[model samples]
Target: MLSKKTKYAFHALTYLGKHRDQKTVLIHDISEEYGISHKFLENILLELRKAGILGSKKGKGGGYYLIKEPKDVALSKVIRLLDGPIALLPCVSLNYYEPCAECKSEALCGLNKVMIQVRDEMLNVLENKSLADILDKE
Candidate 1:
């Protein structure tokens, strides 16, 4: 399940991408446009900025903008950044892998095997999809 934070990030990002022509977009505008709480959206945008996915300006006419072109920002990267490992099982996680404490051997662990397949299938889609792809679908 996608957290409200991740979902809100997408809403804010897609809005920013669509309005790329604008030099900057006010957080209050995005907040009201999407009905997201201003404070919550502020934190999300700040994290994205820190991650280098977004850039912001201060003072008059200041707001957030995408640093990378939409096509260059992969959905998987955003998901991992905001949601941590995409893999369902810690044991099967590629970047955040940790063996199950109860499972003595992953080679014989049915859950691990199944989750690996699940993770691969998910990556097949997420890894190939980008923010541009999402914008195109809109």
Candidate 2:
């Protein structure tokens, strides 16, 4: 399941990507347009800025903007940034791997084998899909 934060991050980024030519976009505008809470959206945008996915400006006519091209921003990166690991089980996680407490050997575990296949298939789609690909469909 995707977290609300991750969903909101995608919404915000998609909005910015669509309006990339604009100098900046006010948070309130995005919040209002998407019916997202201003405060929550603010935090999401701040995190993205810190991640170097977004850039912001202060003062009059200043707001958030996408720093990287939409094609350069992978869906997997955004999801992982906001929602942590993509794997359903900790043992299956590639970046945040942890041995299962009950499982003696990952190679011998039935669940681990199934989950690895699941994770790989999911990653194939996520890693290949970018913000630009998403927007192009729309």
Candidate 3:
């Protein structure tokens, strides 16, 4: 399950991707379109802008826009940015790996083994999919 922050980030990105032709999109417009809280959506966009995925401007006609091309923004990047690790367990996480306190050996842990496979499959899809791919589905 994704946090509302992550989910709303996706919604904003998808909406922006769909309207990439616009100079910039107002935060209120996106929040109104998706029923997301304006302040919450503003924070999410700020995070994305800091991560270099998005760019923003203020004052008249200024708003947010994609800094990177849609095809260059992978689903995995967005997920990791807003949702943290993709793995079910920290023990199975690639970027956020931490040994389980009770587990004697990860090499011998059956749960670890199964979760590795699950994580790999999930990554295979997410890493390959990009904002452009998502936009195409609409």
Alpha-carbon runs more than 4 Å astray in model 3? none
Q: Candidate 1, residues 24-134: lDDT per residue as tens digits?
A: 999999999999999999999999999999999999989999999998888888888788899999999998888888888999898888999999999999898889999
Backbone clash pairs for candidate 1 read none
Instruction: Judge candidate 2 against the unseen true structure and give its global Cα lDDT, from 0 to 1.
Output: 0.94
Clashing pairs in 2: none
Arrange candidates, best TM-score first. Answer: 3, 2, 1
For model 2, what is the error of residue 50's alpha carbon versus the real structure, in angstroms, after optimal superposition?
1.0
TM-scores of the models, in the given order? Answer: 0.95, 0.95, 0.96
- Between which residue pairs do clashes occur in model 3? none
Error of 1 at 124 (Å): 0.9
lDDT per residue (tens digit) for residues 28-129 in model 2: 989999999999999999999999999999999899999999999999999999999999889999988999898898888999989999999999999999
TM-score of 3: 0.96
Candidate 3 lDDT trough over 10 residues, lowest sum? 92-101
Error of 3 at 73 (Å): 0.9
How much RMSD separates candidate 1 from the native structure? 1.0
Question: What TM-score does model 1 achieve against the real structure?
Answer: 0.95
- What local distance difference test score does each model get? 0.92, 0.94, 0.94
